[model samples]
Target: MSTDVAIIGLGIHPFGRTPDRTGLQQCAIAVSDALKEANVAWNAVDFAFGGSTDAGNADTLVSELGLTGIPFMNVANGCATGGSALAAACNTIRSGAGKLGLVCGFDKHARGAFKVNPKEWGLGNWYGEEGFALTTQFFAMKIQRYMHDYGITEVALARVAEKAFRNGALNPNAWRKTPISIDEILTSQMVNDPLRKYMFCSPSEGAVALLVCPASDAEKYTKTPIFVASCLMRTRRFGTLEVFSPSKAIEDQKTVTQDASKVAYEEAGIGPGDIDVAQIQDTESGAEIMHMAENGLCEDGEQEHMLARGETDLNGRLPINTDGGCIANGEPIGASGLRQVHELCLQLRGTAGNRQVKASPKTGYAQVYGAPGVSGVTILNS
Candidate 1:
């Protein structure tokens, strides 16, 4: 369903390593850009919410931000951090507790996949020792099973990566800007069985921020405001089957992405058919394929067909991951979701140069899912 909140400004720090700057520093840069775009001063913000993984607490930003004294919440919900923060910020406005709010995400991670501990995730320590906890391992197994069940090919995986990098080439801020041929991608070293090194996104660093205000007051901030149609976050419930998951859902059941996407669509009063563009989680090529179906953009096994038909191309009927997604942008966990939103806002504003969707997209969708079964979805309309 429609909401009164509209995003008045957007800003981002390029998604990649900046050894000279700390994660929080990057966040500060994004915040300044966003505030400047919205023409809103820091002290004028009624409230703020932000999140990060490796960065310092988001609330600690006040020391450098002039201590506006507004409530600045710190969120840590793994990769879904941005989604949660944005939802909270929207609710703050919808609840009449605040008229203007800011939400941001940023992080800096070491090379390679995250070192996740089962116990740290609330599971037994044995789950980690037995090798049932690594993100790459679980992703590989899940995708392998999905490929078999749906007749997806190894070529499809390479195509996904190829598309991601191709789009990244157009995105100046993307980390992997050079496009690679499918042959080169397919020949890349295999990281986990069918998942090639090129197919997976590295754990990297970046930051993103957005300014939101009541739709009635959007003109006071910016000339082009993307209305917040809906924003919701959900977590996997009982009987959800994620193979490596320590929970009892291994037998298989509804996923958090499915549930969240459905509710988000209902709230936004739109469906997949209305989305001119989309940006779903693509930690790897396989995740993109699975999320396409899980988010109801397509039916089971239809991603292969969708890709084959060029439906996801920049000039096609629906362009997805126009900013290159996680594969080309790298996953800075906290900032990834907001990065998707930022790209969508650009498209809706008709400012996505070089990589812009030729169709003049009016509506967009995004989904971000991560560890502990948390998932978040948002719909935007211009």
Candidate 2:
């Protein structure tokens, strides 16, 4: 017997700038909608897991949403929190510890400057620098390096931004739906060297929730259910330092992303060619290009070629980020991973509407990464 977990229902509370609702309120809205969509009551959830960062305590948020008397846990893996929560829920159900599980993710934009806990990095008040200082700057450096090494042009990056914005225009819930021209993208104020504002992900507030249950209970809830074929997550070992760093001489080293993708493909009994659709975490345009190569969608240094050929567009051979991705949809921090899964579920169910691909998508993949080198990949099949 195949021990496959099923997603009976999914809910997303938009993806954009919202100043009125708190993170807790967004969580409640998503969770309630998920339960109603699955035709299951709150008490039916055998386990609950909330994914967030510094938004608030998961336990308290669950309590505020009236999720009590249940085994609940909080997951904080930076940007990958939502995907981590789903993986945990899948493991619990696969272990037969729970028949039904609920995973909720939400976040509110930081009121002022975004800061990190000093203890996490073993730094004290000396690390009072603004949050974007390190994170965005680090990624900007990577983008510059990638461009130089691969000879990728700015036009290639503009293509990525344009594609995402076009997709976002079709998604009512997306944060920035207005389509931008390549000239506009190139002229946008540069956030970092070689990375314009259009390449950066916008901060937004939203929530997302998912209901996972045993395959047996799938029919009881929704007739058109998606199966969790596999969930894979891996962290970068000291070995990856060589693969990603130009100074290292380790020629055989593999990136943390490729390592995680290998495990996920093996567990799903499929290869990259079998993926019908994908929702990759592209906080920046460069990320999407690099991930395409790292995830085996194309050969190393060939991402720009693929993009120029229109292979990564909505009507392309293997459509990616059909729901606009973090680039165009806005990154709601905690809810991003689940939002990716939600888009995949919608596509697999053939309910994506105007943004749907031409081919019949039977399998979908979602990937998200966070700082501290955390990563998550989930495979869903219809």
Candidate 3:
């Protein structure tokens, strides 16, 4: 028998700009919503895992939810944090170590951008400052190099933003619902060179929770439970500094997204052509296009052409970021990965409402990647 795990229930706090709640409070609300959706009592859960970065204490978030006597752990992997937590929960269920596990991810950007602790290197001018500086500057460098090497135009980036905003208009939970034109994105203020203010993700507060269980218990809860076909996680073994080197060889090897997708496709017994729907980490518009090519959805450098031809729209061959992705939905740090999963779950269950794709989505993939080259890919099947 296959030791497959299934998602019994899933819940998501509205993805928008909300300042009233802290990250912990957002997590508690999501957890309660998921339990109610799953028809499972909070006390009956066997384990709980919280994913976050700057959300105060991880354990405190669970405690605030009135959770006790369950093995609780925290997960932090930059943007891939929530995906990592969900993967761990699936592993536990597959191992028969737990009957029901709750994976919760939340983030409140009201506290401001999460900065890296400079004290970790112990003073006196390290090679680089940690935290938000590295994240913003590192991706900035990559974007510059990509534009230079590929001869990509500014119009390409604008098209990416336009596509995401168009999709976001249909997502009631998205932060930016108004559709933007290519001209508007091009004229937007530049945050990092070549990356405009409209290109980067907006910070917001939100939470997402999932109830995972063994395949045996799926029917007890949900009529439309989605199976966890595969879960894959990878880290940059050579470190981010290598990519910054002035060597052609090193630059060619800086394809972590492609590598992770290869592993996930093998484990799931499928390929990119088999995927009916997908949610990719689009912290910036460039990332959305780059990931599509890197994940084999199209040939390398073909994403721009795909977008120009309207092949990635909601009614196109392969609908991407149907929930507006991190671009329109806002990146809530730890809650991002789970939000992607939640969107995929909704697609598979036919509950996506107005934002639903017309394709018969039998399988879907959700990928979350971070600045340090950490990535997680979860494949779900209906």
Candidate 4:
């Protein structure tokens, strides 16, 4: 039986490079802060789920939080790690496995572009050596095709990046805190055909944790507990094009994000128009532009117009990625999805400070798309 869930507490570590700290330390800070805010002891948490990459097993956090012998599961699903963890926790709770649970995501990787080992995914070693599996190339090719079909321009892409950096300047946890102009982004070095260096999100380190329980009991913890209207995940179908797909077949197949979002909106009894704010995957400016349409936030060819009119700015019709997004916060893989949720939690709670959307946002939406074709979406209300 599905159950109603409420987020009683949320915690996040500043997103950026930190050479001096270990993944465990960062996760500990986030978890401790979450527990303290929830007013729930670590031992009181009935179950736990976490994700990580290059940071070893997530349950290793037991060393820092003390061994409580709870059923802590580890998850790793490329960039959807955190979202998968949340799905597990929420399902476990809904199935009556537990009422109170903890979900954590953390990662720390070396400075540089992420390397794809095709052999790990069953491809030949030559695929890796020749850079045929590079994600940057996939983004460039996809965006080029999108622009060709939808009339999107390089300026539109630059505008998205410009907005991201400008929003990042208001986010204390953002990695790239300085804002840049559209001209600066256009003139930046090109990493691929159409994707410039400034247009892409950098890989970095960070951690985020959430405390969830039945909404009936949320008032015991906080008066402003955010309710989880829906949380869902989806994988690509046969005709879907993805970051590491073998083909870019343009067929009648719908994207995983589109499907997941449709289910989420239905379950929540709401539509995109009902959402007041959002935090979508912006691994690059192009991804953000495409996702705006894919997630049903707008029409296919409306991004160019919406972006040009500042319709997506902080004070615009629908403020999005108000906390800098991946472009400014950096992508920490396992930690990224939860970071989006954390930012929305702050916005709904009216505690987002400098980056808060005006006019009092009552509903929020978040979506995360990952490599090899996977997507996760969540809807929340205050």
What TM-score would candidate 4 get against the native? 0.98
Candidate 2 has its poorest 10 consecutive residues by lDDT at 240-249
Better of 1 and 3 by TM-score: 1
Best by lDDT: 1
Model 3 weakest lDDT span, ten residues long: 239-248
In model 2, the number of clashes is 0
Model 1 residue 72 CA deviation (Å) reads 0.4
Q: Write the per-residue lDDT of candidate 2 for residues 1-382, one digit (tens) a residue.
A: 1437999988888877677887777888888899999998888888988877646766675566564588889988778888889999999998999999998898877632245554574455444443432456556776788889888888888889989999999888788899998899999998877888998886678889999999888999998899998886777765553212223345446767788888888888889999999999797888888878778777868888788898888899989999899888777778999999999999999999889988989999999877756678998999
TM-scores of the models, in the given order?
0.98, 0.93, 0.92, 0.98
Which regions of candidate 3 are displaced past 4 Å? Answer: 1-3, 110-114, 118-132, 239-251
What candidate 1 gets wrong by more than 4 Å, as runs, is 247-251
Of candidates 3 and 2, the better by lDDT: 2
Task: Give the per-residue lDDT digits (tens) of candidate 4, residues 36-149.
Answer: 998888999889999988777889898899898989999888788888888888888788898899999998987878878887766788777777888778778878989999
lDDT for model 4:
0.89
Decide which is better by TM-score, 2 or 4: 4
